[model samples]
Target: MIAKSNEARCTSCHAGYGWKGNDFDFTDQTGVDCLVCHEQTGTYKKFPAGAGNPAPREMVFPGNGKTYHPPDWNKVAQSVGRPTRNNCGTCHFFGGGGDGVKHGDLDSSLMKPNKMLDVHMGTDGQNFDCVRCHSTTLHNIAGRVYTTPAYEHRKSLIEDDLASKITCESCHSSSPHKEDAKANDHTDKVACQSCHVPRFARVNPTKMWWDWSQAGKKKNGKPYKVKGELERPEYDTLKGDMKWAKDVVPEYYWYNGSIEHLTVKDVIDPGKDVVINRPVGDKDDIHSRIFPFKVHRGKQPYDKVNKTLVVPHLFPKGPADADAYWKTFDWGKAIAFGMDYTGLPYSGEYDFVETSYVFPITHMVAPKDNVVACKECHAHEGGRLAKLTGFYMPGRDNFRALDTLGWIVVIGALLGVVLHGLGRVFTANGRKEQ
Candidate 1:
């Protein structure tokens, strides 16, 4: 709960004011930090731990020693305009503690992308802002990830009654391929992102793994971090072992837009990998289509006896919060404190469980030339969609009886053509002799 622990390290971005506790009024318009989204001055920044409020005065942040200065209210207020890529990315790009950590497709790189990175958002291309497609009306932005339909029925804006919510069909109609009729036929079975996006984390490395079991390790009585690829942390004493990846190929799945999340009270099977959140759809589902996803795998604390995932108070309240896992480096104390605060029943026994979370890849739109090739998914060996079975694909699938019968018919047709040509030559020679 926000009333306890340092979860504001994660929640502050979603909360609009000093929402460090539950008592923070959600209905109060005075608490809204409009500058976060509207200010064009390019100076406003939310303090990482300030519960959504900008620093009241100049101060230096601890550890990183980054200096924070209060914004010039008059300058920022006068400069307020429509939100740009920078405005939306302030929180989204830095989700899950750092840039490109949560959503592999979204990052600061998109703020000023090149044509190869994103055709729409590229500074050198269409130069469209995030609000261009995600049109806002009365604070409700179009294209909410989880709430959106898996596939849009509308062909274009002409037929779309749900004008406020945008999809690929909003601009690029269902049959977008003018040249390739085969690609157009794929619309009913495959998502646009499954082909257009191709890969995510193109510009930056995204976090792929986090093992909480490896946390609390220290060197010489002091916690430290070990940097790995791209100078990113592979191991942090405060968190755990981490794995990051760049230009990652996505896992294909049948998603119908619905997602099932594992709650704290939900029972789980320790024998299997616990899916933290999964897209709800199957091959037989009419609404489902083959979509791309960044599947993040990790290990996290769970109640062994209750068979439920447990939340650990990882972030500290301040420098000397003994109950916090980051400060004390004690799992027992941290889990106990967190479980107690949440009013969840927790047995004394705890263990780490393998978990997976799925993130749909939609951003980092490549140019038409860079879209996923037909061979990538339609090949017989090692295809991208090889894992998704129960469907007949042209080049990817084969039926032994059908293949044999087709080859026989082709051979018979060739023999018939040769014999007819020879008979015609013989008849011409006999006529000449007569």
Candidate 2:
């Protein structure tokens, strides 16, 4: 789907080369140009100094030469993220036919964006305006925007560890792989995209919800339909079967609040009950960094599951055991059992999942151990004494438990020393009497 921006507008990145359709213009500074987005546009100028050198490819301006950099190259021009009220709203302002509030209803801005009718999601809270966070602009356009550290999605990703493909291995290798007859050894494997590369931009952070009303057997993940409208992938399933999705999975109700959808419904358990409890589009995910790119948190080689993150599970209303569905899980056990439960099937040395399916699509080099870093190491710490309880959900505090254990150990050691001292005194008295 198109962004919530003006259709005739030009892209911030591709300056002179191209624009969406035929809307791009070289001299159209009134709309968009290389300098329109790239240049550190201060008060709108004809040009800046250092006209001889050109800017770097990441931030190429229309006319200005590259900004001179120091020896370290750390001073690379930082590109702004979100649009500023002045930068974007100017075109979308009054006389231009923009929403009078800059981020409000569409009235008169240059040309209004087509996405959101109202900018902010708040219905009752303080009405947020463009100038709230983005108070300044380079070319009267703000550079970056504020974001949440964590996510706010409908589907609880705790159980969908198999779906997240942050690392190279996940997409590259399929699970339940039994290469050898004995199924004990696996040494070799390949990256995922080797075979299942994408025709379109099938990148990270996919939507994980399905509309049950629009779902069926083939669409419900029934025995991998190859040639029906109910195919799983819908457009691209495996490498050679890219055409299978249209035939296999028809009427796929996947929508990321936009088109080019990716979905997984029956979220309560991959569609046992027909009603959908989770819909990805309903999520309001906020990223600590550049969204999907910052998949891992805490450290490198982190738990890919935690990296994907999720909202607290919402119990189904219609389902019989809706309460059971909402039952708090042994979050630690869930992860530990996941690891200890299903070790990767290696081919004496090579993995069959990596060899046959997952690796080709992911284009990832299969992990040697096939073990999740966070699951194995974090067992007793936050893993053991965890909880997801109440309407205002909060995870259990395991650190406090550890501290209590530490005090117990310390007191136990002191008691042992006191007992030893008493025993020595008793022994000395007995020897003296003798």
Candidate 3:
């Protein structure tokens, strides 16, 4: 999707200033906007379409209708401090267009959460900042996306000197439950987030489904928007049909930290569901554990002849642009432009193909009282872990032969006990006569 986006629109949240093209210098430390992360002043704002530049003068952005004011350089410089929740949330909460859009576990609600919402980030509870877990070294933050391994070895801070402090195991050791050995034992097979964070999008609704095939529908002369069940725009002329949900029960998967992704040029089967990325592990893998994920399903364009996914130019450069899907609403022109930009060949004929992308749920740490109960995943029917097979869960799995043998053993033991008691009673009379 980065290929479909304009740098001006996409890089405002991530890339520092003047990163409009490939020629942008990556080694220049001066270009790095330290104020964006370190400034204590809440006034520091990046222009939405400024390609990582702040507003030169006071002006409103035409895209989002938000007014931007040039920061007072002296005031901001004096207020330089460690990054706060607001500093990190400024970019992360707004990723993928708006708040709670990209990541269901992260949103503006976390900024001032209560203990019930998040035990760590809650202002009324532990009140831990983002840096508390995501320790930084030379500005290379500790956390990595699920597509890559965050830690080579899983160990607590006291266990190893080289272990990453980002993992939950780093702080809360492998055996965190003090009294419950059963729960502590489950840690080996289940991820901490899988049980600790039972559901995601607990506070705000997140987009669960998107259909790009339904895009380009416009009202007479101008593009229009329609609100859906969540009171948010479900159908947009630019994007398409979207379905939103809150308090979402996450889909479970066996993840070993690393993942495999489908590249833009990779061949895909049009008949099957195109997985954007998949976790790389199985039940047998030693490092793998049952992790929770928010699966976002969608339908997007793919070349029928080339048998590859096509990236459409989605953001418009300006009002006069014709190829961008936002402005022109022409899939052919947008796909052609985006493909040319990426130096990939695209067949003239294109059709929509189903796709699925997953985001790991790692945030929204609930209190101990709110943790998922044992029966949620260990019950005989409709369990959270019903889809997971090959493992013999104590209460959930049953074998007919094993049950029959167990019952026979119990019956034989009871019969032997009764016969021994009867024999002892019969011998009591003879012993008295002797």
Candidate 4:
């Protein structure tokens, strides 16, 4: 199941490499094609149907009685230079098959962005690239995955260093706000991205929901799809029903830089929505901070008999693969093939259950001037952090005793000032009459 899906879905972005065979063997040096990243020629293309390899020009127009000439490999090699945002955007920006499908923070708009869109990558600002923050060394990147971070602190590079040194603090420092002490104090309880990002999918809509239970719906014996607003697919026979949103405010959560992922082996309760992945943190933890996240909700397949999530073979490598879900639209066949491929047991019973996965919003950092204001989260009611507990925000959270004491102090001060003014005015009038 994994192999078949990789051959179809994974290859969409992992293409242009020389990957071979069905298994994921890192020893297969053939898969690592340097030209995919270094080649400056836009003519370089990859075959999405193949396993991340450049498609033969003939395959594009097969048997047309025309001999299609290949691109000049020598010229492309000579033109190779540093990778640009376009090279990285080819995979990162279009993560889950389409533009703004996975990460709300990333999209094609980052390419040649202006200062209004992003402060770092803006053409009018710093104009920094991905490598600037995600610095790499010896092919090991400095950034962490969305679910986990190897390191959250800046450290010197050394052998056997497992922690990642790349972080917003590496440049911004712990005290980012120089003028505002109040803003600087928030660093301990709030993440840099929480206020800076404000919102995600600012330029494009991101996939907010996926309902696999609705898949395999066909009309007139043909797979059907419905288009939604902004040219996004509302429903598809292959995937399922989807919901998308733009300029979305992120869900706030306290994150301590740890995560728990629901693996294939974990048994889940059928009654509740299973969390596919979530950050492990709380308001009480010292290391934790209020962070912004994109909570992606979906309905995915699970083994009704075994009570565990099942990975289905959604894509097929060839036309003859009947077990492929997209090709056959048969859940039973797809689940069976998937379980057998993964060497897991199947009880022949499958059902769809609601699930959710959380993705941290770290990109699309707006300019300092455009950050979330204090009142957004510090209001008396309906604040952004109103749902967050364990800490007492000045205006948001209230204690009865503290409020009474504060009112008493204020009234006492006001009465004293009024009495002193009245006494002075009466004494002056008496002196004038005398």
Per-model TM against the reference: 0.88, 0.21, 0.90, 0.85
- Clash count for candidate 1 is 0
Which candidate number would show the highest TM-score if scored against the true structure?
Answer: 3
lDDT by residue (1-434, candidate 2, tens digit) is 11111122223322333333334454665443433323333332221211212223234232224333322122223433344444433333421111221111222321322112222312233233444423343444332212221112222224454333233223233332466522122212211222122111111111122121111233354323243343223221111122111101001111122212211210122212222111122122221110011010011011222221111112222235222112222222222322322242111211001000000011111123332232322254453112211212123334678789999999999999999889889898478777
User: Each candidate: what lDDT?
Assistant: 0.83, 0.26, 0.86, 0.79
Candidate with best lDDT: 3
Q: In candidate 3, which residue pairs clash?
A: none
Cα deviation in Å at residue 315, candidate 2?
Answer: 42
Give each model's clash number. Answer: 0, 65, 0, 0
lDDT of 1 at 416: 96
Measured over all alpha carbons after superposition, the RMSD of each candidate to the real structure, in angstroms, is: 4.7, 25.7, 5.0, 5.4
lDDT of 3: 0.86
TM-score of candidate 4 to 2 decimals: 0.85
Rank the candidate models, highest lDDT first: 3, 1, 4, 2
Instruction: Sort the predicted structures by TM-score, highest score first.
Output: 3, 1, 4, 2
Prediction 3 TM-score vs. true: 0.90
Comparison by lDDT, 1 against 4, better one: 1
Model 4 whole-model lDDT (C-alpha atoms): 0.79
